[model samples]
Target: MALTPDEIDGLRELILAVYGPVTEELLRDLCRCITAAGQISSGDEYKLLLAKSLAGADDVIADTLRRQTDLTDDAVEQLMRWAAEKTAPLEENESLRNIAEAYVKVTRKEVANVLGQLAAADVDGRVYPIKDVYRRTMDYVFREVSSGTKTPEEAVRRATLRLWQRGIRTVDRSDGRTFSVEFMAQRAIMAKMGEMTTAINEKHHDDGGCDGWEISAHSASAPDHEPYQGRQYSDKEYKRLNSRLQRRIGTLSCKHIAWPIKLGVDSPQWTNEQLAEMARENAKGVTYEGRHYTQYEATQQQKALENSIRQCKDRIAAAQEEGKLGSGELRSSRILLRQLNAEYKRFSAAAGLRTAPERLRAAGLGRALRPDGTLEMPRPAGTLTGSGGKLDVEEARKSYSAYLDTLTDAPEKNMVWLRYFTEKNPTEYMEDGTLDAPFAYDPVEDRILYNPRHPQFSTTDFEMANTHELAHRTDVLNAQGYKNKAFVDAISDASKAVLDNAEGFQRVAQAVRSDLMKDILSALSSGRLDTGFGHKAEYWAKNSEAVPLEIFAELFTMETRNDSDLFFVKKLFPGLWKEYQKLF
Candidate 1:
């Protein structure tokens, strides 16, 4: 089994607990030393005072190293139990249990030895002995205070920030590489789990005399491994393939697993076309703040943001503990934390990714505070309001929120208000009766007017209408209104693609089909062409210029809901689908 977010968080917390507190205390002591050494005339005099202040610092460092080793051993024990539970049935066998235990024992020692090193570097690329890092930090603090460049409190806060940002680095001098203690621990744990699982699976395959295996499939798989997933391969063929791949299956950080299968009995789990579509969807990732990010890239961004938030919280706590609650550092850090939290929500909503609360937590940190001293919490992405209607207002809001959750690229928060009306119409009908449509987008007022009393107000119908109207609002905000040249060109290309595959279009479910010809004919005969049609294109020929806008909205709804019409669009109108994806 893969490591869950909770499990990862727990491991990180344990690793940080081992070193984080020790580093914090060290900084605190150094700050105290700097504060006590007031107005030293020369560097030598300041060094003497600092050395006296941190008299037993060496002993403290030694004690911390010992504690870290002990904690690492304990963490490894927990990790082993987790791994054993994941490979359950196999653990019942004594031989396998013994094998796993022996491997864990050896890995545990290596992890402990590596973590015992206290070599770390600061933000300015200054490397220092873990024991001597505090001295250098205090020296910098003293210089700033004595030179009148910063107050004693400000210098202390800066030192705290630097320590939290870098954490305690475990350096590998051989390759000149450094890793935070938490990162190193995570890597060791994942590697151990992967190796154990692979060993157990191989033993099973051997005992069963299996000649073939199937690899598991997951979203956002690495491109090199995408083709091999959800497919059955003979043992020999798989071996040959694995040898040539850059990242082989069952490797560290590779989530794929090879399960034993009978050569002629088991079939592939997914069809080639489905796999191809999955790849296409992964490639066409969501857009946030004008930057495109694949699913994997988005998750990575979330991790970075989560780390920064934790650092901010830590800085605030350290400042408060030092009785510098009103310090500029504390105030700025609080403001930045709030901004990070809000940005996290907006980015997650836009990318259609769920936020992991566990990842945002840090030990000994309370809720962030606002300028008024009240606790601050993140707000929802948008709001829904209903007026003058028998509509289940709460239900409507819930339904709208649910649709937003399903969107890969959601509209900007509060970009358009949602107003529902059940007993009355908000806008007069157009000459061709398009304005009286069930859902209408009012660009001037920046709201979507929904008439739930319309005949097509079933659950599914409501969802479709919601999506269709939201698409129009999104288009207007993003594409400079629906009649822009770029949108019109895209619609023209998609229309051509649809025209080329008229037979396929006819096969689409009637409810989902956009019958442009019927609308064009009605507009020609109705004599309503003189007066321009409103928001929607009920009569295409009447407002020929709006054909692209109407088609774009319909296609957007289909794509968002994954309606069957979209399958036909992708199959028969590849050009159209490709163009449609770019508009978002």
Candidate 2:
């Protein structure tokens, strides 16, 4: 088959237009999946990239083959009708019919083979290596396709030709199984004609021989065979012609064509400059959503959103792992994450992208903080909260589960179970004169021991009991002794450093350094530091034995209640307050 330069050029144009956008969209989806999985290395990333490309190729080829069959069927039917309309009817109609039928079957098999190869690669997580020249050809093909100017037929032809060229190029260097482009084109022409011949012969079996039918061979590439040019044969004779002269016509680099009869063809033949101009026309950017984006620019935007969401999820995981969920910084981080999630949702919706369901994890745990900037319970549905006369074990369990969601630690998750206990005497205060605290956390057992007595429940309050004990447990299970004497000593050292450098405090606070020190010391010793009278000496040891844990528990409780206790604590231990925030 001798295809004019114009037809080849038109075929290239059609293939680019059809395959461009489809391939681009596929690549974007694949990139997002890989980024979300946190696979960034070159080899691993490229493996997925290749898998997606193969899948894209399967789609491109499948669509192309379907379209090619439609066009071939139409072209052959038109040619057959034109031949039958002639004053002197021609033969070879059977050959044309058989070729069209065979072409469809052969191309369908080829498409299926490509799809099967891609499926195997996907299952094995393997990537085929692309040669540099083939990669460049595909890149150019994508650009032209994205330009959106070529017809579907041209796009399909160009895609098929490029891939065909790659195979032929490699086979020549390896085993020489396929000789040249002309040989390949000629073989395709023969296959189509052969199928058409078979179909026509089956239909005209009652007719003896091909009386009015004629098959002719034409080729500009084989001018030396002028004797064979315009050679006509009957339908039955055409079937034998292949065997008679198969060696010369079906060999390496042979460019030949067999037309059923008279042929009148007119197609645009582009000049070198005109072809260059056509390529320029196909290089223009596509417009979407009021903005123009090159294929590369659109790909970059897709990658940025995918990577940003992945990073946000990673941070949340890290904070949970470190058990710093209660800190002010982590509270702020959660707020930032909420904002990122909203952004992700909007971006994906706008781009018509689908995000993973895992992105919705911890949706209810938004930025909920107490007034003093401590993180609060997420309070997801089904968590128990209010008070009643008798203890409802199930409700208590649900409420405790909700509270536990706010904390982070092994003990907080596992051993810190809740149970009710009662004292022999129902007194408002312990014998030690400390107020009878309703709930006490047992360090040894890692449990919250609750006073179930009616008098204690009424006086102690539900939220207070829940928040205070959880805070105590957070200190024991997660924060450990980070809030203890060592922490206080760091405060003392920082205080000494600041006070000794009086100019520093003067600059930051605009206060007299001596007066500030005097105020802090006075407040620390005023017995007000021992605020919130509590039951059992175990909860708050006297004097210096009062672990920083008690002070933190009290402050956290006060913060949750929105009381002024946080301010008092800050004033009494200004140095500790400054250092405490950093420690947690």
lDDT for each of the candidates? Answer: 0.56, 0.38
Instruction: Report the C-alpha lDDT of model 2 over 60-156, residue by residue, as the tens digit.
Output: 5455445444444443344323322221123455554444445456644532332222211111122232233223333333444445554323432
lDDT value for candidate 2?
0.38
> Candidate 2: misplaced stretches above 4 Å?
1-337, 340-390, 403-435, 454-456, 459-464, 482-484, 490-526, 529-543, 555-574, 581-584
Q: Could you say which candidate leads in lDDT?
A: 1
Using TM-score, give the best candidate's number.
Answer: 1
> TM-score of model 2 relative to the true fold?
0.25
Counting clashing residue pairs in each candidate, in order, gives: 0, 22
